[model samples]
Target chain A: MAVDKKFVGKTWPTMVYEVGKEKVKEFAKAIKSNNPYYLNDEFASQSKYKTIVAPPTFAVVFGAKLIEPIFMDKELNLNVAMLVHGEQEFEFYTMVKAGDILYSNTRIIGIEHKEKLDVVAIEIMTKNQYNQDVSKGIYTFVVRK
Target chain B: MKAMYEKNSIDAGDTFNAQQKIDKYRAIYYAGASGDFNPIHIDAEFGKMVGLGGAILQGLCTLGFTADAVTTWIGDPGRLKKIKCRFSLPVKIGDTITIEGLVTEVHEDTGTVVIKVINQNGGDVLTNVQAEVVTK
Candidate 1:
């Protein structure tokens, strides 16, 4: 069955995630990155950003928090077992630093039913405590029947 | 050391390669870091039950590697302006992913890099991988 096209514009409560310095370091380590911008405090303190900053793909860490609600929503009824990530995109604006409170909003942007699979897309827009755009991520998934 | 792009002058044909040996615990650590605890990524039995063979690595984790290759080469994380890719294969434990990046185009003030991500078997793991950075 095809995902309801009517859910295209459906949205959930906006999620607020606080970027933590240690959490950033943990994520950096998981990706096997030892970038000073993400780890070294004194080195990053001397850099242009003036402090530890999250990696470019760190957007996914915050973005993942919002994705869970969508995947678990009974109304959407996503086939969790058969769904696989199809594609991902990220456009970085202002780098996210520790101690920044980010507000993220995600919505169902598209739901297309193809011959072999159903493709669902959700776009997430995030901004910081300063209301500056942090980054935008579009996560696409393929649900095989 | 981190601002090498500003020093090296990134141009067309410039290339760099980064390799990662995906350890068995990669997914568990990734799940803790990224909040993706899907069974297909962490539970081997569940993953096999679902026909994934065994616990597979998260697609985002693989993309993280792809982005890291570019930022590592460019030397400035903020200089990486854009990145996108499609997950073409399931990366499992013990797989070695090789990320090869080529500066395919350089415009007046920006450089475009085309990336090829492949597993040890030479199978495409992620396709259409690309990133763009500020050059000016």
Candidate 2:
């Protein structure tokens, strides 16, 4: 079944994620990144940010929480077995640092049904504890029929 | 060294590259860190049953590698303002991924880089990759 177009404007509940220093390091190591801004505390402290900043792709960590719920949504009934991430796009307004609390809100931005598959795009906007915009991620998934 | 894009010296056709080895434990570590516990990425038998041959690496992890290449070239995490990619192929555990960024356009305040992520077999894993960074 194709994903219903009515859910195109649907929204999900807000989720809050606390960035951890160790997790930031773990993510960097997982990606095999040796950048000091994410790993070396001394190097990061002396830098302009004066703190260890999470990598650009770290947005996905928090963004995933919002994304998962959409897949599990009974109304949407996403076919998990046939779904694959088609593409991803992110626009960062500011870099997030360790210990910062981020609030994420996701909504369905676009839904299209092609001949063999259906594509759904979710836009997630993350904000800092101070209400400053951190990053915007557009996650697109293709569900094959 | 500061991770600032040298606006004056860099122009279209400038390039930077980085290579990462996807070790055996890569998928496990990435699954734990990213909270993506999909069986297709963690279970070899399940992957084979699903026709993926064996457990495949997470697409997001590959994207992470691509982002690492970009930030490594710029030398600062904050300098990267935007990045996107299409997951074109399945990256296995032993594959060596290489990311190459070509400066396609440069303006007063920003530069656009066209990135290509390829595997050890010269397969394009992430195609149509583009990144926008702050140069000013």
- Indicate the DockQ of the complex predicted as candidate 2: 0.79
Candidate 1 C-alpha lDDT tens digits along A1-145: 7778899999888899999999999999999996788889988897888889999999999898898888899999998777888999999999999889999999999999999899999999999999999899999999997
Worst 10 residues of 2 chain B by lDDT: B1-10
lDDT of all predictions: 0.90, 0.89
How do the predictions measure up, each by TM-score? Answer: 0.96, 0.96
- How big is the positional error of residue B49 in model 2, measured in Å on the Cα after superposition? 0.6
Which has the greatest lDDT? 1
DockQ metric for all predictions: 0.79, 0.79
For all predictions, the C-alpha RMSD in Å is 1.4, 1.8
Docking level for model 2 = medium
Tell me the deviation in Å of residue A124 in model 2. 0.4
